[model samples]
Target: MARARICKPCLWTALLGIGFLFIWYFKVLALGYYWLSTTVNAAQWEGSSLWLPGYQVAVEARPIEGLTRNTSGLTFNNETGTLFTVINRPPQIAELTTDGRLLRVIELEGARDPEGITYVQGDTYVISDEHSDSMYWVRIGPDTRHVSIAARSSLGIRIDSVHNSSFEGVSWDSEQNRLFVVKEKLPLRVLVIKGLDVFSESRGFNIDISEWKSSSAASLFMSDLSSLTLHEPTGHLLLLSDESALVVEYAPDGQPIGMLPLWRGFNGLQRKVPQPEGLAVGPDSALYVLSEPNLFYRFERIQKPAVAAN
Candidate 1:
């Protein structure tokens, strides 16, 4: 008997069907990989605690020292009374004396465009890549400084993906034991991560960002919000924006109370503060603001002109 032969139409149809199946299989695989990566990153993020609406306060501008251009976030050490500011482009954290002097510069590792800086338990916490969500913790010691990789999840917050969440401002509430983070713009809101102490104990915490809820009170500065700091003594929240020449103060309930314009000149000195990014309140109730390209301002509360002494 002659060997059976496949028909031409059947052969062509079989080949086409196989090709289509292969294409569909690869397409699904590619999508699955992309989704897996996203899920993994999201699983790594941790959420924050203590959500509150924020408002703005008026600030008087006095000059200070040590901050270079691109200073982003600011935090005050109630224990030491020192102000911490993070310089992005160059990725340097500077400690300033309340008197407007540059005291020390803490060099950071793997800090790609750091924007927020806060001090927790004597260690410096820095948030990097405002456009891309990533965080780092640099421990500054009296003898030697050490750098470590930190995950938002470590603090019980989840990050859905590295590309989804970009954190611009960060502040630690020692009293409440929480970390507050702010996104740059509209839907402009702050996130509170709880169980910070638990993560600090573990030294490696991962939080899911999907669980984070936006603060009903916090609003972005007119342009880009560079940083935010909490006033320990007063429970006030301060917000800074580079585009707007102003710093705002908000209450815990997110009610705007006052506004501070960057003073052009004061004390008979001509001061130009361009791109004010970082803000910190000192123990003496003085406000410290840092601008890009290297400039610091100290605003001392002057008792509202003493009511002209009656």
Candidate 2:
């Protein structure tokens, strides 16, 4: 009997094709994993049981011409009764009226990427730098128009350096005497800080930091934590995202109880918010948001109809 004839060229070609397929499959899997892990909306599919109430957009995205093009974080100052926002390009803070009119501008020194700001108490405020994991304690008064490097001091949280994963949002709970700082992803962690003497002149003080986690909570369908606002009356937090164009409300225990989409048609918006970088709740419980390239947004609650007499 004759031995079976073998085609060597065909065998080599088949083996090479199989090897290429194996490598291609792994490359696709690795890319999918990276995208899923980095995207915020991907986390929302992980099964959460919390219910969230949506909000109505009172004022859609409007343009402001006389301000910095890159607005990052927003904080409502009850003292001045005005909204404060920061610009990352020149590292300056600008005060704006409720109608998006620019009031004042104060340049900041010794800060890189000032992304988040929260009014702590009195004239003291907390500001976060995105590039550096540094939080600054700054005091602004009637006589103050600019924040020099000498007047600014780091709060010293001692977080490990991660590129662009630094603090992005900040909220102050005056009643609890705690500061809630939101990290801009990788895990989307909220840092609850207590016992950090923010109003002191000394640079040395101990801070107690704890991660806020909820058992049955709704996921924040946000790409990055751009800003946060603490609603005192409801004891809830409004978290802002730049990429996802969303604002998620979280209860005191970190449970997401409400949400408001910045995109059009979802929240009565005629146009979608381009880039929401900062958010704040005014004294009257009005939601104020700042978008990149100088845009302002306002959201108000919808009042239900009164019940008829029985």
The model with the greatest lDDT is 2
What are the per-residue Cα lDDT tens digits for candidate 2 across 1-310? Answer: 9998899999999999999688556645643443444244424522221112334777667676678487888898887888888788888888888767888889888888888888887888888888777788888776677896555667755465578877888888887888989888775777889877777877776778898765343354455677777766556666787877777666576655446667678767888888888888776556788989798888755542121100
Clashes of each: 60, 0
What local distance difference test score does each model get? 0.56, 0.72
Model 1, C-alpha of 236: deviation from truth (Å):
2.1
The lowest-lDDT stretch of 10 consecutive residues in candidate 2 is 45-54
TM-score of 2: 0.77
True-structure lDDT of candidate 1: 0.56
For each candidate in turn, the TM-score is 0.63, 0.77
Kindly list the per-residue Cα lDDT of model 1 for residues 1-310, writing each as its tens digit: 8999879999999999999688556645643453344335432211111111111223334344445366667777766767777766666777766655777886655566777777777654545456446555556655434344443322323343344235777877777777778766543456777654433435655442322331431233244466777776556677776655656555566644455555454322254456776777655555667666556666654332211100
Residue 85 CA displacement from its true place in model 2, Å: 0.9
